[model samples]
Target: DAGVTQSPTHLIKTRGQQVTLRCSPKSGHDTVSWYQQALGQGPQFIFQYYEEEERQRGNFPDRFSGHQFPNYSSELNVNALLLGDSALYLCASSLALELRGYTFGSGTRLTVV
Candidate 1:
């Protein structure tokens, strides 16, 4: 079975531009979540989507948003990107009823210059 997949493994954007990262969940998975990892820090939860609705969100600003489609695929969008926003964006997928573990994608590395 295929695992989570993220598009455009790497991206470069300006300080004020917007960026959208895409993710397709693993087979048989119904929940999708997003995280941000800086150079040295561990992944920080950005938000989670279940049943096509955002179920939980972290401390990120309003500029960060996400969407989960009926097919269980997802997208993460960041508006007015800042240099500080540069990080590895990870997508994780798991069955909502069986939340023992998650399968994560390699991640999309975003660079703001």
Candidate 2:
């Protein structure tokens, strides 16, 4: 089965632009988490979603936003992008309260010029 799926594996945008990254969770999973991974660094939690609501968030600014659909798919939206926003955006899926582990997608590589 498809663990998770993210579109536009690679993307290029200019500063001040906005981008939306999409993710489809694995079958039977009701929770989704978004992460940002920079070069030479570990992934940083961005947010988590369950029941189409944002249940938790990290230290990111308001420019980072997300939405989870009833189908358990999700989207990460970044507005007024900055160069620092360039990174590997990861999408992970899991069952709420299960907590065993999460299935991650290949990720989308966003580059801000």
Q: Which candidate gets the maximum lDDT versus the true structure? A: 1
lDDT of 1 at 12: 100
Evaluate model 2: give its lDDT: 0.95
| TM-score of every prediction relative to native | 0.98, 0.98
User: C-alpha displacement of 52 in model 1, angstroms?
Assistant: 0.7
Q: Give the TM-score of candidate 2.
A: 0.98
Q: After superposition, how far is residue 58 of candidate 2 from its true place, in Å?
A: 0.2
Summarize candidate 1's per-residue lDDT along 19-93 as a digit string, tens digits: 999999999999999999999999999999999999999999999999999999999999999999999999999
lDDT of 2 by residue, 1-113 (tens): 87799998999999999999999998888999999999999999999999999999999999999999989999999999999999999999999988457999999999999
